[model samples]
Target: MRITELIDRTTLFDRILLVFLLFVTGASIVLIPLYLPHGGQIRIEVNNKLLYKLPINEDKTIPIGGLTVEIKAGKVRVADSDCPGKICVKQGWIDSGAIICLPNRVVITVEGTAAAPKGVDATT
Candidate 1:
């Protein structure tokens, strides 16, 4: 593609689209992992009792109804939580590879021989 030709076709919409796409691409690189944690799992443990498990990852983006969570390499937190706490929801995206919600009885812990962060806790 010729630089001059590319410049010539540049319109407001084109510029906007280009900028938007760039922002999206850049953000996706970082955000993709959080929305879907790399644990290969969606486990539910009730009072130390194993409830259930599902295969998932950082790209899977476990959704808790109105809440959105981004799983990282260590712990998972509520990227968005439908529940009232928003506390778990607003923990600002973590991934010591483990995320758990005491209230909802929801637990997400990442485990795949992957690296874990120094200090990550889903409960906090």
Candidate 2:
């Protein structure tokens, strides 16, 4: 009887541990980006296609791989996704954000700041 009880507890412990690990991993993935500053202009390319170039002034949106991305306050995130899981969409807005859709061979990311590099004329 004691051996059976021990086995049952071990199984329960394993299940609990699995749940905890999953939660920790998921939280880390979401929270990690928030701490980093993502302010800047953005360049998105999908399958070598130039999707959009946006400045970090106000909210903006774009389409990549047939998906729509919404940006606000320097956060670049997928508002829609063609692929399953929708992890990219769930990732919310990211200021230096990136999402990969392997099926569509697409990648979206935020980059660049409002200020151009020294000696560089953006008007050119």
Candidate 3:
């Protein structure tokens, strides 16, 4: 039978309770992410080793090996690198995701307050 038929068979209080529960579930799904704090720092790594967990709020330039990462106004970009492709530099500034240079083995990731996965040295 249809879900509406089942609801119709229930008493008024039961129907109201079910509706309230559904509303709560839906609200939580929509609001939880909005309330979660955005990541305030950039996690930099090279060859799977933690390099830096610098705050994105302050503009800075970091030189990790042959790669130069520039952080400005809460965003980061691969300003320069010795890698041949230069794909990492072309990716542009980003507030999230990652800017990875395979040749130089440099990785920059933006994360929220959530902790990085276990065994991963990238997040500090």
Candidate 4:
């Protein structure tokens, strides 16, 4: 019937287990950024202008527009942002693909290795 009544039906162990799970999930969400691996070369752009091209091996921080991009130990991520949602910061580390902050017009992408195609060998 009532919401409280339904909760009351649950045993104390069940409630404790639910609370434990919630705590674990929330903690994991907050700590995930610390464990993500960094990727290749990084290209950062802000407000439609090419800003910085950095090697992934270096550890540095760059302030671009309203966001702070952090590169460390061969990984890259938006460490801080002035935008409303901080969506870019939540993107964590990216080895490939792009992390875009629409509100601040900041874009970060991991550049892949470029290898020229070899000429075709003799074919019978």
Best by lDDT: 3
Question: Candidate 4: which stretches are off by over 4 Å?
Answer: 1-38, 114-124
Please give each candidate's TM-score: 0.37, 0.56, 0.61, 0.59
- In model 3, which residue pairs have backbone atoms overlapping below 3 Å? 39-112
Which candidate should be chosen as best, given TM-score against the real structure?
A: 3
lDDT for each residue of candidate 2 in 1-124, tens digit (9 for 90 to 100): 7887876767767988989999999998899777644777777777788767777667877666568877777677778877877777777766665777666666776665665567858696
Q: Write the per-residue lDDT of candidate 3 for residues 1-124, one digit (tens) a residue.
A: 9999876788989878989999999998788656644557788988999879888888998788888899998889998889899999999988867888999988888877546567747565
lDDT of 1 by residue, 5-115 (tens): 989978999989989999999998778666654444556454566654544444445566455665555445567666666566655654434566667766655544444
Candidates arranged by TM-score, highest first: 3, 4, 2, 1
lDDT of each: 0.60, 0.72, 0.84, 0.81
Model 4 over residues 1-124: C-alpha lDDT tens digits?
9999998899989989999999999998778655543365788888888888888788999888788888887778899999899888998987766799999988887775442356885671
Which regions in candidate 1 have their CA more than 4 angstroms from the true location?
A: 1-58, 72-75, 112-124
What would you estimate as the lDDT of candidate 4? Answer: 0.81
Q: Per lDDT, what order, best first? A: 3, 4, 2, 1
